[model samples]
Target: MHYRLICFDLDGTLVETAPEILDAVNDTLEQFDLPGVEQSQVERWIGHGTHELLVQALAYASGVEVQAVRAMPRLFAIGQAFDDHYARRCGTRGRLYPSVRETLYELREHGVRLAVVTNKESRYTQRVLSQHGLNTCFDRVVSGDTLPAKKPDPRGIEDCMRAFAVPPGRTLFVGDSSIDAATARRAGVAVWLLPYGYNMGQPIEACAPDRTIPSLASITDTASSSSSS
Candidate 1:
């Protein structure tokens, strides 16, 4: 394939983590006597990291604006509670997307370096990757907290490209959201978005990613095309 390095987004991209994320959110909400949110809402709120999702949930439950949730004097305590709940719920119900493991192996076998750049916080990202047995597949992992800024800023993708010594033309970002598409665009790399992952309730096609892929399995075609050429 033309690409030397591939960076992935977590949550909706690599893992279907909304089920557990919903569980964690509701768990935290119940502790504070707040109404629980639905899985659909949680899925829609994903891609921004756990804290942001929790803020959205609290906002919805309390009929307060997201900014109000963020400004709540006890927001820190509430965030801490959410952290504990999410940590416990991290890997319990999450699963890798179709063809993810096989594709990761295929790419690795062909000398394609892999990395994960996720808006998910470091703790949740590590737990999910380890639970899915994907820890060793990546040459590097850059979580939301790893850098000063997260997705749409492109720092994570750029950092991975620099670490791999690969230029934008040789790098590809695979993800499931507009955030990922924007990040890759800003970094001058190609991005392929999956249709099934979270795109903030919008169609992935609307994001106008370089390619709107059906699944991770299609990535293997790159190797075949390279060989045939």
Candidate 2:
């Protein structure tokens, strides 16, 4: 096999999780009697994980700086409230990006180990995967809470490499944001960015990924080219 493993970012790469995330954030805001945030606002806040998302959203809704919100005595309680709301809302309305399911099967058939590396908490990540019938697609999953550090740190990707016994040279990270690109770079692995994901409202090309594809349907092309090279 040219590449032994293909590690994927969950939100914006394999799945359109913003809807569910938006719902949870808005619901939590409503619970606290704060104004709900818009989907576009939540999209920009994603890729950073749930805690950061909530911090930014709460700040936006309350017209305060993020640090101010963080210093609030109720921040922890609000985070817990978000956890509860997000748990109930996970995968309730999100969807797999086009060609994701088929592409995973194709890659797996060629003996490539697949894994999910996301900033989402493990509990919600697992729940979302199962809800989308994607639990079996990946051989392993590494979430934000899986280790002390998350994306933009290389531990998650490195962990996946170790689990699959694949070296950085033989691994590819597929994702949709600068966070993903930075993670892959820190791990010394190649990365491919998808054009359609969130990416904090920036163009995926701005991340300078090794390659950009419109969808996962073209992943086999990357695999084939790598094998030939």
Candidate 3:
């Protein structure tokens, strides 16, 4: 196989987490007497993590002016509250994407090393993985809070490569956003994208993934062959 390591983005790629995340966000907003965000808008605000999501959600909810929202000292309080709420609610309503488990098992059985690199807090990422019985599939997992930098920064990808002792040319990143593409570009790894994932309200095809597949299972054949080569 041409690739020695495979890394995945968590949120939309492997799991359908929109419902849970949206519920948690809306719950927090309601608690603060703030208006809730629409599901479509919430999809666009995701990928950056909870704090950024809340900031954007609040800005949208308030309609008070983006600059004004940034100036609000209470924004931090809201963010913290949202974090707590999400901690309790995340994964509750989410499920692994179709065929994700089967694909992961196939890749693992084929001797392909796997890892997860997500812009989610480590605790939350672990919680979701554990809930879905996916924690054991990956050789390593890197979360946004695990290091000083996150996706699109390339540091997380570099860390994954170092952890696996895999060269950049032999590593492949599977993700759902432009951030993943940017990280792959910076880290010198090949990237494949899933068409159904969230890409900040933009079309994921525009991110220019090397290959776009409809489901995780679609990569099983490729992964198996690549690992043997």
Task: Work out the TM-score per prediction.
Answer: 0.96, 0.97, 0.93
Global lDDT of each model?
Answer: 0.91, 0.92, 0.87
Give the runs in model 2 whose Cα sits over 4 Å from its true position.
none
Worst 10 residues of 1 by lDDT: 220-229
Candidate 3 residue lDDT tens string, 7-86? 99998899988889899899998998988888888788779976677778888887877678778988878878877888
Query: Candidate 2, 223: how far from true, in Å?
Result: 1.4
Better of 1 and 2 by lDDT: 2
In model 3, the runs with Cα more than 4 Å from the true position are: 224-229
lDDT of 1 by residue, 26-61 (tens): 999999999999999998999888888888999999
Error of 2 at 96 (Å): 0.7
